[model samples]
Target: MTENGAQLFARLETRPCLKDIEPQLFPEGGGPNHGEVVELYGTEGTGKTEMLYHLLCRCVLPVATGGLEVDVVFVDTDYSLDMLRLVSILESRLNAGSSSSAESDEAALRLCLSRLLVVHCSSSSQLLLTLHFLETSLSSRPGLALLLIDSISAFYWLDRCEGGASAIRQEEKLRKCAELLGRLLSDYRITVFTTCHAIKKVYNGPSSGSGYDRPYLCRPWQRLVTHRLLCSRQETNSVAPSAGGSEEQSRRQVFTVHCTSSGSRTKAYRSSSFCVTDGGVKFI
Candidate 1:
């Protein structure tokens, strides 16, 4: 059946807008909308995974429990997802929201976890296949509003080695992956959040200190990104002496996160600082 122009416009207007998953990082309030892609790139140990966990919790938990209450698909390319850590953070968030008994909290936790679908991909080929699978899954589940890929650049080196001297062949897999992502966004209108690592260093460049490393991925993947968040970390001054003495200072480390948006309506630059704790990434 075909729809008229007025009908199409009405349907578009009825589409829901996703809530801001990380208000601390995007202080302006509007979060990634449907069909938008957000990329977080930085060096290792910069709390990118921790930030993903935070956002994951926000999507999986129920609305009454202070979450967006939408389902999420997490693609673990680096094999770095710590389920125990994610559960701990979710439990803490749930505990803070209500004074429910231990048994009830456990039940709530289970319910939240049920909404998240985790897929593991060891190589670029597998990642591409996984996205194809997700397209079918998304078509069946309208509640699935977010798609996350931890370190989309995971297979860069391996693919480059396999491609062997041919630049086009080297980037072929990732380029296809990006094309699939674009298709998924267009068809399902789901938001995407992926992480990238800083594989190269830049000197005297515009994004040198802005947390954006040299672009190492293919142009297709780069162009697919609607919002690029450059992440970086640095050790700050030691906290004031506490009852634990020097022990506290050594264990605690604070790092700042800088975010810059390209292709956004406002085209603004924002930065936020956060520290990773036993629970999760705590913004300051």
Candidate 2:
């Protein structure tokens, strides 16, 4: 049975796109759409995971609180997910909204947390299995709109060592993972967000060689990425006037996120700066 054009357009209207997650990061207002993959790559401590948390929060919160109110499946391969940190940020976001009683806030927090499904994977094989499991889970839950995998390159060196001199064997597991991900995207209307660590040193001058910062992942995984975000961090000094008429010097870390899209249409490259505070990521 083929659907008519009117029915197809109606179905498209109901699909969710994350263009409003962070306008500052995606100034063009074209965020990750359904069945699309977005990759974030950077060195450690550059706030890649923190950005994931922010995006996850946006998906899980209710519509009344300015969130998408959709379910999220978060696959944690690096074992770096801090539930306490996520809860703290969620609490702050909830509190910043309309004032309510403590009981109501707690209930809202629980409701938001309920929308998230967290799975931990210790190895590449486990990660692959997890994706298979997610297919069944997504089928039962129509509200699941986002899938997050923190640091998909967590097992890069391990696979390399195990493969020895065979390049084909080295990328075998991830290649399969990429294939499975593509199938999942085709079967479901969900968006994927994964992180890749920067393996090579970053150079800033024009003399830098070509392919210096190219992604080290296999072609299968790289080909699935529709948006690539390069993250970097820098430290800056801030001086404030104290009540006692003395100057106070403090240092703060700032993260710069630049995004490039590789789709049918051209999009202007955009970048934004932000700082990670106790509350969450505050864009500047």
RMSD value for candidate 2: 3.3
Residues 53-90, candidate 1, lDDT per residue (tens digit)? 98889888888877888889999999989999999999
Question: Model 2, range 1-284, lDDT digits (tens) per residue?
Answer: 35655554454456577766678877656887778899998889999999999999989988887789988999999999999999999999999956799999999999999999999999899999999999888766777889999979999999999989999999999999999999888767689999888877566777765432578889999889999898889999999889999999989999999888877768658888999989888999
Report residue 97 deviation for candidate 1 (angstroms): 4.5
The TM-score leader among the candidates is 2
Write down the TM-score for model 2: 0.92
Residue 191, candidate 1: C-alpha displacement in angstroms: 0.8
Best by lDDT: 2
* Per-residue error (Å), model 2, residue 27: 2.8
Q: Model 1, residue 13: what's the lDDT?
A: 50
Worst 10 residues of 2 by lDDT: 4-13
